[model samples]
Target chain A: MSTNREIHLASRPQGWPTAENFRLVETEVPTPGAGQIVVRNRFMSVDPYMRGRMNDVKSYVPPFALDAPLDGGAIGEVVASEAEGFKPGDTVLHGLGWREYALLDARAARAVDPSLAPVSAYLSVLGMTGLTAYAGLLDVAEMKPGETVFVSGAAGAVGSMVGQIAKLRGAARVVGSAGSAAKVERLKALGFDAAFDYHDGPVYEQLKAAAPDGVDVYFDNVGSDHLEAAIGAMNLHGRAAICGMIAQYNSTEPPAAPRNLALVIGKRLTLRGFLVGDHGHLREQFVQEMAGWLRDDKISYDETVVEGIENAPQAFLGVLRGENLGKMLVRV
Target chain B: MSTNREIHLASRPQGWPTAENFRLVETEVPTPGAGQIVVRNRFMSVDPYMRGRMNDVKSYVPPFALDAPLDGGAIGEVVASEAEGFKPGDTVLHGLGWREYALLDARAARAVDPSLAPVSAYLSVLGMTGLTAYAGLLDVAEMKPGETVFVSGAAGAVGSMVGQIAKLRGAARVVGSAGSAAKVERLKALGFDAAFDYHDGPVYEQLKAAAPDGVDVYFDNVGSDHLEAAIGAMNLHGRAAICGMIAQYNSTEPPAAPRNLALVIGKRLTLRGFLVGDHGHLREQFVQEMAGWLRDDKISYDETVVEGIENAPQAFLGVLRGENLGKMLVRV
Candidate 1:
């Protein structure tokens, strides 16, 4: 008999979640039955949205079940397979729990090649996160060539991809906003024509400094204040794709948006809220395009890796606070 | 030579425009040229949108020429025609200014069937304003049958049509918000299941009281506070079609949205801003459908006419303040 280690939801958080909300426990490792495969975790994602899943409420996706393993994006190797699609020694990615090993359906497991890209990339640039940036930027934002594109949370996983993708799509200018000076510089190095440290002052000053002509399209990852700033900077007939609101997610007090909703009319702009799953049909197309870009060295990625599964709760908390530069991952 | 009594833009206003901003001037009536017709004004429209025209900066349409005839939607009688299609005493509709007489291109005039619909009705119900309400509600909002629709400025011209159209399309429940108790009652009489006066404390409170289960779609005419209220009351996957922002037009101070924009992601709503001319391709389709609805009594319309061309500015100010119920017009 082998031991299966898992992290379960110890409690629901009110504001910012504490480590006390998560519990690590050991269980008996059962054999995989028909149509099931066993995966030994290698890498796991600690994303901003994971904080939302821990709450017991309605959202785009269902909340994490109480007294159960908290599932998230994980890359692993098929240790055993009793299903047609997967075999032992094959590398895979799936929505698996915070555990050392997991029993999953063959359909849930996608066998990925290690030759084309690094294996951990499945948790980021080549995975669900990348697909989100692609669909929201291209399909939703309707980003046209030569238009200026601005992104919030510029140094984070999704925002980093959003800026780079906008540049690759031939945007005349690409601007990004991040929390730290280091992250801002990092974003500029990743092809963002201009990047601002939002913490230093009001976003209006930073944005004006970066994009004087105003932005034609804005991909918002950090909501609240960022949305207000984007509105001030959108040009006539501009488009804003609402992606995430990490800044306001932890606020128990009602959110505050400084007046600028009227900008929608003065500018004749279109503000659209979107979900990544709504664009799942674009996944194959995204993979093809992203693969070509990666092969040509036209795209690059960064990851902030935590060493162990036991530190996942802390890693997730850090992601929400902008503590990681790039995709936050845990090496299990 | 006959005198052409005209209303001209005398000055730009700071807030809540007054008579000082408009001037009625008298000039010689021009004789028609080879392809032109002399149009005698019969009916003119005074809409809330004209407020935007009063500003100095450019918008969807250029600002009204200062100290010149402020021309817009009007129905007139062709007193003289040197063109093939038009005849003497031909009842036509054109952008003939707020004047007793004027010369215009015959091609710019469209013959009006006053026998089918009243001449003033053509200026409101079958005019640009009607088409705007219809297109925004049906096309941009993409309103589905049996969905709940909430309209702001429900007793106003476009709002009235929006509610009726949603009802005609089999809406589940239609709620509205007006500025007065009389207007609230008028909305109920016009088939709105529920309505409240916006002056009754916070709009969010009144909105929630009216739509307890939450709103599926919102037709926004008055932006800022009303918009934030609607955003707070929307259900999951809701849609908001922004037709106008009458509330913010005359404000001397910049209005800030106190409502948090993050609610957009929480509810996954879509808010789109549109102009009627942008959807010009639907003109023929609109005429056929709106005409049929009128003949079958499937729809009804209302109007508030302020006599004399000089009072156009007053009527426009009244329309913006929600003092006029239904479509505001100036009969010259």
Candidate 2:
């Protein structure tokens, strides 16, 4: 047995989660049982979705159990194994995050080739984050070739990938909205045809100026004003894939829905909400396509790596505050 | 030429429309030009959608021209024909209402057999109203055989047909909400498994009591409280066909959107807004199936016919106020 440090949900958050809601504790790392492997986690992800999990309400994912280790996407090196095809030093991806080490069933962990790309990518562009952008754009929104695409939270993990994927797929115009002028410049550098800082003016005015002809598809991560603006700027038969509403996740009061939603009737718009867990069937296809794109230099990714498991809470809070320019992760 | 009395838009209404917004004027009915027929209208439909046309804003149909005769669904007998397919004494359906006579292009009119069903049925159950219910449920909502269906405006023409169609297509349960207690009982009489008066109590509590297992499809006609309530009681993968929002149509202020819209993510809900005009491809199939259902007594219909063209404006206002039980029509 060995000692490991892990973060636990000390209490459910009422509004914006605070560091007090999390507790870092040292515990014994159990030896591998039959069909189990022990892993020393190298990287763990902190995402906007985690804020929803901290609430005690039932959602697509269950709330983090009080005083228990909170789990999410993690990449690690296998230290010991008791199952067939067992090997030490094999890098694996699993759902055992916010921890220094994890004892996981072999079925829960999948081996990833470190030589294909950096192992940390397994927790980001090569993992659930990448798959979300792919499935959401191609399937949920049903993006078509040469159609215009608009994305909110363009500097974040899913939004950045959405804009790039849309571009690579032959989108005519790619427009993105971010919180700051710096993020807007970063989006332009990332190949977005048009980018705007939502802080510069009203989102509706900014979006109207960015997409004068209206957008065909809107990939929404930040809801509220962004969603309302998208609804106003959508073309006939436009589609909106509601991936995340990070803007309203921490609000104690129920956020008002878009007042212009009635415009959906006149425009024949479709707004659908989705979670990535329901789309595991697309993983193999996403991995194959994304690998080709990365090898051809058609896509790029960035990560803001916080140093330790103890800082996971702060990293997650940083994601909500728009402090991260791309995927936010903790280097455990 | 013959003298004809027609209804015209005198002025646009600011909030709820009043009789003063309409003008009844006498004009010369034009002689049939080449490929045109002069029809003496028998019945004119006063539908909720017409109220939208009273506004000058662009929509699926152009706004009713100010100080000119308003046009809508009408059934009439051809008095003079200069077209190949039409002749004198033939009953036809055309888009020229609020007038005693109309000069219509033969191609714009469809022959209706009064011997098979009431000629007015062409303007109600056998026409656009039926098509709206059919395509909205099967195509827009993508309803399955055993899912629960919830409809608002259940006592209205489209809503009544929607509930009946869902039941006939093997819905596990059919629930509806209307404005009056009598309308609730009428919905139950029309094969709706459960019905409620939205005015009796909070819509959420009533819908929850009516459908304990939750609704899988919501055919929304009355938006606002009903839509919000349906969202709350919807199951995973639920779909809402936004056919109309009678509740908010006349409101000067924008109605608040559903407060719990974030639930859309966890529930995987799809909300699509559609107009019946876009679903014309389903007309042949809808007419065939609905004709069979009507012939077999599997479906039924009702109408509140106002006596004359002079009462048409009042009948239209009645539709907005939820005063009509089913289809509201004006007889010439």
Candidate 3:
């Protein structure tokens, strides 16, 4: 039997995670039982939301058990299958724990068509991140043609998709905020009408100067300051879709919203916090549309990939710090 | 020509407005020319939104001109008319300035039918306050039958209407939060399934304990802390209609929000801010429905009438401070 490397929690971080918080262990690979297949992980994702899981707080998803193997979105190759609809040497994506080799139930894995897109692409562009952007912007934000759209963290995996999708849906202007100059440039090349480097100044001023007419739809990836800024810059009857708050993720203290919330009354703004998982009906439609965009080169994606399972915790910490560009990934 | 007594803005306030900010001015009442009419004022209104207009800031409506008479909702009798549709002695409601007498263009005012509801009801239940409650709850909150609803400031004019209307629509249960014990008692009598004083304890704990199944809809008349508490107590796929943020109206400093915004991602919550002016499409339908409710005694309204125009500033400041139990009005 082959030995596989696994990454387990060393200890939970108080705020930002560190490499020391993860412990690498080696375990013997067991034979696949009935209706099970062995998956050899190729690439894993490290997202900003993983920071919340490091704490023992009650949330939508349950907290990760202490000293247990960490799991996230992963793409792998099936070396062995003990059930139908699977065979030896097939690539798949599943919610298996972070390990070089994993024995997963055959029913839990779906065959990945390599000819359709890159295996790593599934972890970013054609995966949960893409679906989140589409559902939150279209279904929750209720974006209409000819309206101005603003996105926070515009260079991230989800923001990039949101800007492009807005353009495809005929948005009059698409503005986005990024942490670095390079990301802002990338946002422009990806069809954003305007992009601002948030580090240049208080995001409120930069956002106001960028969209003078006021934003019609605000896709919030960073909350608190961003939300307050959007409230100030929104036109009458604006809609705000709150998807993430990466800005407040590492704060031990409570977040403070600006007093401008009073604008909510006069402007008739709609601020909705939504999750993509809530809209199950849109899955097939999203997959079809996103696949077409990928095939036709209408959509482009960026990734900051790190190699080896030992680096997952550090990469996660980096994501929480906004150090990585686009979607943070680990190539095992 | 007849003389009219008008209340003009003398200065703006720092925190709570005082009587010194307003000055009663004497002016000649002009005769009706073309479509104009002279209205003998009966009941005048002072609302929290006027606080925003007092500041020389850009908003939905332009700031009140410095050293000029303040205009707001008013009910009066048309003592003279020069327009088609309006006749002498016809009672009307319009955006008339705070004064003993108002000279207005006839088309700017609407005739009030006291046979359907009382003339004061035009400034309260059949006016903007009632429309605000209707549009916020039905159009913005999107209430479902048998769903639980939670409303803040339930004894206030807007909140009172919201709770009663939700009950009329077959709400499973409606819980309300008010500032005083008397207001809480009034809310329970106003058809609230449960009522609590916010001064009792932490609203988060109170709301969570009272709404174990979680509130499906929240009609937010008070913002800041109340919003944070509601966020914690919301059920999966909840909707919040942000009508007004009375809690933060007088705070010089911004208030802090709980670090629970990320809960929106898990629960698929939608928090939308709105103003009644944008929902003019529902005006006639709301008037018809609310008038019927009032006639059948299915609806009840309360008013705190401050006697005379000289007390308008004090009355407005009182409304902002939540000192008025229901719709605060001035008898001219």
lDDT of each: 0.86, 0.92, 0.86
State the lDDT of candidate 2 residue by residue for A97-212, as single tens digits.
88999898999999999999999898889999999999999989999999999999999999999999999999999999998889998999999999999889999999999999
Model 2, runs deviating above 4 Å: none
Give me the displacement of residue B173 in model 1, in angstroms: 3.6
Worst ten-residue run, lDDT, model 2 chain B?
A: B52-61
Residue by residue across B182-280, what tens digits does model 3's lDDT show? Answer: 999898888888888999999988888777788999999888778889989998889999887777666666666545666777778887777787889
Alpha carbon deviation, residue B242, candidate 2 (Å): 1.0
TM-score of each: 0.88, 0.98, 0.96
Model 3: what TM-score? 0.96
lDDT by residue (tens digit), candidate 2, B188-266: 8999999999889999999999999999999999888898999999999999999999998899997885878888888
1 versus 3: better lDDT goes to: 1
By TM-score: ranked, best first: 2, 3, 1
Clashing pairs in 2: none
- The model with the greatest TM-score is 2
Steric clash pairs (candidate 1): A259-B256, A259-B257
Expressed between 0 and 1, the share of native interface contacts present in candidate 3 is 0.81
Clashes of each: 2, 0, 1
Candidate order, DockQ descending: 2, 3, 1
